[model samples]
Target: MTKGRRRTTRDADHESFDTAYDAIMARWPDGTESLTVPTPYGPTRVHACGPRGAPPLVLLPGGGATSAGWYALAAELSKTHRVFAVDLVGDAGHSAPDPQRPVRSVGDLTAWLDALLDGLSIGLPSGPPVDLCGHSYGAWIALHYALHAPTRVRRTVLLDPTGCFAGFRASYLLRALPMLLRPSARRVRRFLEWETAGGAPLDPALLRLQERAAVLPAVRPVTGPRPDPAALRGLRCPVLLLLAGDGRAHDPHRVAARASAVLPEVTATVLPGVSHHVLPYAMHADVHGRTAAFLGPLSRPSR
Candidate 1:
């Protein structure tokens, strides 16, 4: 690579963004390997750790947080499973989307995950059912995917999932609109600060990356009607739903009650004092301990 050539502004911005992203990823456990797997929608980037033969656990991060945001959670899960934290296509992070085959619908997003799992050699004939974990928007993806392919997912963990058991609060959406419609670093910081509401402080590196990503071009996230309550009842895989007591996204108690009633097998717990956006990284020890206990020991040694 030559360093003397003048770079375009977009190129420089991407480089700077990558630098900020890497700074946060530095917290990942030792020997974490970055892998790029080809999918029809795009080449997916995954941060993987854990033993080769352990049960596979796929992690999906919230919108804009990227796979790097799961460093803390991934480290703990890696102890018992072969953890693969994915950089969702069409979102922030190293994953690139092929404009020709954009993810335009929830179905397309699920198909992308199908291809990604195949590329990663997880699920179906290639390997055993995976343990899926997600946060916020990522949790929605995880839940949808579990419903989309129940046979392939052994268990699921959702951290303050939005749009699963309840809808977002009107106030939360109003606060987020400015950041969504016309993003700026200031808006990003303000939205997070407001949502986190003085909970445990967010990681400085991840916060910097979020601010940098605010202005980056992003494909509109695929959105649709929430999964039907009947469908939720039919999902056979056990689920662990962790809610934030102070979360303003939706009424956590309502979410818990609805989820407990609708989900055939679910354990819903609300962590007091935490807020929505910060739940993933804020309550590290509690999240890890609860998640590990729910997923249980690996089923069998990886073959």
Candidate 2:
């Protein structure tokens, strides 16, 4: 009976999470399509939109933010580029994790990304390199992938990325401890409230989805040391590093200084009045303008 009850509770948590996710997705622009691309890790869920022949721009959301969280930004980028917003493997969204092939390390994570890109038919031989953009933890993944396969990526964008250039603020880690140690809806909400303090109000639907994320069965995310500074200096692709001026996660100025100094080709900017968790969403207009400017005009239709 105990086992059965546990199973039932897990099922309910998944249901609630989907309901909230769907609610948020319902607001996405017209013609948006959700498809699953199979990878060795699992079937990755991607929300695709924009013209089919346009250059692909992949968006990776922060941890627990889900692909649906990119709705607003996706809509903007989709106008000029095909947008593929992904639900990361082993996370709380629609993507399923292969228990047998768990992503155990940063190496595994990069391999999973390679398979995912191949499944999507991106990169050399057939298709041109795609632009990669990510936020927070997702930004970490994007940076690592760019380093792993520079030839496969045309450009990269990192939005308030953590653990890439600077260490996390000790106070920020302390506040996240409760949610990390004993995750609950209340704890998740509390964490967001504290971190996003002084930022514009967040979308209610997005908040609901995040709260439900706490109860969903999720795999432990891969964690590792910061990328080597030597590797940063070696990266060749154009990069846009956008920091949240009010972010409590780390010193935005310090991040800017380090990134500008190490990266061979980088454009770093700080968007004031927004915090880490509320970014891209909070500074929608500013983020879109800078991103589109950096990405330049859309690609010509594939021959």
Q: Mind giving the per-residue lDDT tens digits that candidate 2 earns over 190-228?
A: 989988888766677888899999987789998999988
lDDT of candidates 1 onward, in order? 0.88, 0.88
- Residue-level lDDT tens digits of model 1 in 154-173: 89999999878788999999
Assess the local accuracy of residue 109 in candidate 2 as a C-alpha lDDT between 0 and 100: 88
Worst 10 residues of 2 by lDDT: 294-303
Instruction: Give the TM-score comparing model 1 with the true structure, all chains together.
Output: 0.95
| TM-score (C-alpha, index-matched) for candidate 2 | 0.94
Per-candidate clashes, comma-separated: 1, 0
Q: Estimate each model's TM-score.
A: 0.95, 0.94
Displacement of the residue 76 alpha carbon in candidate 2, Å: 0.5
True-structure lDDT of candidate 2: 0.88
